[model samples]
Target: MRLRRLFLLLLCGLRAEIQEQDVRAMVGSDVRLGCTYPEGGSFDLNDLFVYWQIPVPGKPNTNSVVTYHLPENSSAGHSDSHYRDRAWLSPDRMRQGDFSLQLRNVTPQDEQKFNCLVFRKSLELKKILEVVVTLHVAANYSMPVVSGPSQDEELTFTCKSVNGYPRPNVYWINKTDNSLLDEALQNSTVSLNARGLYDVVSVLRVRRSPSVNVGCCIENVLLHQNLTSGQPEMFAGDKRSVTDGPAHDTLEAGNKPVFSVLGVLVVAVAVAAGWLCRHRCPHRSHAELV
Candidate 1:
């Protein structure tokens, strides 16, 4: 009987080793880290304690995010100042064995590994359970802004997107034809802002060509979404091609012919209206009226 009880106890302890979990959160949103006791044991709320923490970069010590103690029936003062007002645990649900932490107003800095620990105590007995969760924060990027293909011999244009997380990528696309551009034509740079969001810019330099339609695209790999500015369909170049490549000058050149055709049609419509009125209206003889 003693050996059997020891074997069951060992199995229970092994079960408490919580499996790692992955969490993805968006910037400026709230996130929840889930932790709960495994089956085979009831959680005693009278002497329960829960703690959530994250590893400090380049330091041996971990940073305290939040903590809850049921014995005191209070849970506000135990967290680090950085997460004092932002982290929360539900006392009511905790009574039912839920010890999740809800983190509010998440930012890029919140992307890290979070450790959850639960402690329970009874007369002459104590137990602890741990769970490690990896959190990834994503921020959507704005549409890439493409500016300038200077009318000089060598056209130069710049593309930029701000306030993105995990470092978004920017590249030049041939709007004239839906295809990737040559790597030589694009130069990209990424920088982080004070808030930890990424700022990206790309410069494109190519020889001046009237048939080339170009645009810039920004993509967030985490979200699997991309946005492009100055689409090729807005230009009048090649209708059959998927990508467009041209500057405003070429677009205007394409527009002049279309406008000229419209001008001629308007003049013909005015002449026809005048001719119809003259022939269809009833005319009184000038001699009889006099």
Candidate 2:
């Protein structure tokens, strides 16, 4: 009976060990790390102490530490200088079996194994939570370029730019007044060939006139309100003068009056012929005997 009792006690201890809590989490996002004792165990929040430490790679070692105690609801200790202001214990949710620690504005440097330890009246338990955080920082912005024929001629303008992190906001701007233009011309058709990367073409019809200046601007919506303009290009038609070409010939323009006069005379002759034929053969039927 003594041997049987000892075996039962050993089995019970093994079961308790298996029931202890564990921790797990992902990177660049929020995570919770804490411990829980078996139900009816002589343990409370005050009896447990929790902390996180980054362990050496493939070895049992640690260089940084963060410790927290309950009720006071504040960090009790920190071995790493970097985590001093960024790591803290969450007071509001810790008492309800939430040994979860809250780390804000997490950086890649904080990624590692975290040790959560619980102690009460000579009974002690420890769980290790592993953390992996990825670092992501967006690069610089690039201005869009506008290309094609000069503005004075009936021409198409194409705007293009590269895709960047945080997805930039791109649009066209009139350089003269610094005002925003319709994504494309109002009467023109606008096609967004690709998102992030884009090409938009706008056609403008201009009469014989002098060169005019225009600009195409691209902007980052989240970072700035001002726009970056493309190099100024003059309209080609604006460079021409009246004396540089032959005199404006209305006849060559297809507006000659002779065509209209001929059309009117033909209509008048047709009407007169119909009137004479009707009078001379009044009441005559083609099929009647002579």
Q: Which prediction has the highest TM-score against the true structure?
A: 1
RMSD of each: 18.2, 25.7
Over the stretch 107-215, how does candidate 2's per-residue lDDT look in tens digits? 4344445644433323533232223222232323344344533443354454444433334454444434444455434233333333322233333222332333344
Q: How many residue pairs clash in model 2?
A: 5
Screening candidate 2 with a backbone cut-off below 3 angstroms (N, C-alpha, C), the clashing residue pairs are 151-235, 152-235, 209-238, 210-238, 211-238
Off by over 4 Å in 1: 1-15, 40-42, 61-65, 123-125, 231-250, 254-290
Error of 1 at 151 (Å): 2.4
Question: What lDDT tens digits, residue by residue, belong to model 1 across residues 50-148?
Answer: 667787688866354455554566663344666777888877667677778888999898888888766564522234577888989999766556666
For candidate 1, report its TM-score: 0.71
- The lDDT of each candidate is 0.63, 0.39
Judge candidate 1 at residue 148 and give its lDDT: 60
Error of 2 at 250 (Å): 41
